[model samples]
Target: MKIGNLIRLVIFGLLLVFLIQPELFAGFFGLFTKNNQPAIYNQGSLLDITLNHLGIVAAATLASTIIAVGLAIVVTRPFGAEFLPLSRSLANIGQTFPPVAVLALAVPMLGFGTAPTLVALFLYGLLPIFENTLTGLTNLPPAVTDAAKGVGMSGWQRLIKVELPLALPVILAGVRLSVVISLATATIGSTVAARTLGEVIIAGLLSSNTAFVLQGGLIVGVLAVLIYDALSALERFLMKRTGQLGRA
Candidate 1:
């Protein structure tokens, strides 16, 4: 009901309209320029592709968030600080590795389809989520920890009741970043016969049909926008509800 929400809705409507009916806008303006081929947008293929892509992305993201954040928590204390740099280095290496190379090496073991792609996506998601989780929990005010101790709260109780809630916003923002990255990386799954929005783009690239590429890329962008926007809104809502952040 708020004006900001209204504006978000309006923008979403416009994006949906264009994504669902790209030809309407494409035909209005001459955007396709490839090998002089007629533009084509295959709806069924696009839908199937996007769905599979989202599936791989979601699985990878969920797995990465669990593993990365768990490890981050394990390595943050005085006794564990020695492990912090190692954990961070591994995270950095995960991001530095080429997903294409990962896929190539994994293909022999995992075969084709979504499995290898899932591994690559999972690896890509680990660093940001891990770093964010660590930073969020560490940023807590020392006074809050003291207050928890003064109340005779157990360590786990302090973590669950105070740290987790206070750190949730930053963790959620990290999740948002991983989500967008996941959506984009899912496109690469198409190389291994895994369905995704990248199918059209790759097909276009191979066949010299620019419209096909444009359609796929645009749809992926639109989906990313929708998912990120929703997550961002959810983050804001939770932060406000927790009283950890001021309401806008």
Candidate 2:
């Protein structure tokens, strides 16, 4: 692994350690187990909580990525240019609005448990993806396209062989950003009973068992790092396959 990758791995481990401090201490100082009832969540297990958050975050991110990419493709096209600003702004607004506020507003209709969070997270994750897609596609060098055109390649051919290949790395970078953000945001799902890592945090807060919160938060943080690292590796693999990154 590169020095940078090693550094990131170390940092992630340190972060996990800090977040789970209460648990580590609970086993020693016994401060955590004192007066703690079996946590309301699955006999004090944080696994259930972490899984729920990850599920919603993953699902919402997938939906957002698909929609964002589609809208990005259309918005970058000439016919879509006139309204591009509006589309971009709407995506931004989605990110800017608080997830909790969105939950409150949406809960009346959505009624709870994953649906509101799914909608809000999808909206929240849109801008980075949509904007990045726009930037990546537009920033392609003119010479690449001119060469394709000069060689009598059709528009579709130019996009597939020239534009998309070159633009994919940047586009995937945006995807990485959205995925990480979605994972962190998934904690908000707990407030609506969406079965996520948030349950750990909330349960800890409610019961005053700091260890529970720490455990959940630590796991969630680790999960986020793992998720992001995997996506980054995938991005690198794609970049290499596309000739955007140098091959080993």
Candidate 3:
């Protein structure tokens, strides 16, 4: 294996160790803090919180992608072109409104737990995915689209087989960004009583435990970097399959 792959494995191994057995690093965590207490997030199992965190992010990203991509497809269609501005404005509203504000507003109606967090994350993730989808669809080569029509393909067939396949790289790019952002942002969900890694950091803040804060931050950071690299590899693979990478 390449050295880079080996390094990635080491990083992933350490992150897994931290998640599954954080106390193993207590001695190391003690070096940073004056207090001799073991640096650990003991309120709940780290693995469970991590799983919950990932699940919430995945669900929110999936929902946002569906809505954003569907809206993009609709507005880009000839019959729906007139709604582009309205669709753009509506999508922008999510990004325009602060996530914290959305949480504050949503919690009143949705009431605590994961519901409000889902709404906040879904809204927070919409703009990038929607904009990327719009860009991908609009920027398709005219000749390529013309060729699809020349082949006697129906509009639906052209979109499904040609346009969507060509646009997928850009769409996945948007999804990647959303997923990474959601991974970090989901930590905030714990404030509203949702199970997440943020709970570890928040608990540390409330009790002045630097160890808790560092561990929580480290876990989330590591997860983001690993996921980003993995997605980048996937994107490159897709590009390669589509002959987009070799041309350049």
C-alpha RMSD for every candidate: 2.8, 4.3, 1.2
Per-residue CA lDDT of model 1 for 1-248, tens digit only, reads: 99877877887786566655656665632467655565666535454566677888889999989988887788875668789888888778658888888889889999998898898988889998998999889988788889999999987798889988888888888989998998988888889977778788888888777788877887788778888989998898888887766633
Question: 2 or 3: which has the higher TM-score?
Answer: 3
* Candidate 3: segments with Cα more than 4 A from true spot: none
Q: lDDT winner among the candidates?
A: 3
10 residues in a row with least lDDT, candidate 3: 31-40
Q: Determine which window of 10 residues in candidate 2 has minimal summed lDDT.
A: 38-47
Evaluate all candidate structures by whole-model CA lDDT and list the values in order: 0.81, 0.75, 0.89
Q: Is candidate 1 or candidate 2 better by lDDT?
A: 1
Q: Residue 23 lDDT in model 2? A: 45
**Poorest stretch of ten by lDDT in candidate 1:** 40-49
Per-residue lDDT of candidate 2, residues 1-248 (tens digit): 99978888887776455444424444442445457554333444454455567678778888887888778777777788787878888788776888888888889999989899998899898888888888878987777778889999987788778887777778788888887888878888778878777777777788777766766776777777777887788888877887667732
For TM-score, candidate 1 versus 2, the one ahead is 1
Off by over 4 Å in 2: 1-31, 36-45, 246-248
Q: Name model 1 segments beyond 4 Å from true.
A: 1-4, 10-38
Per-residue lDDT for 1-248 in model 3, tens only? 99987999999998888888888987888775655655677788989999999999999999999999999999999999999999888888878887788888999899999999999899989988999999989988898999999999998999999998888888888989999999999899998999989999998888888888998898899999999889888888887887678753
Total colliding residue pairs, candidate 1? 0
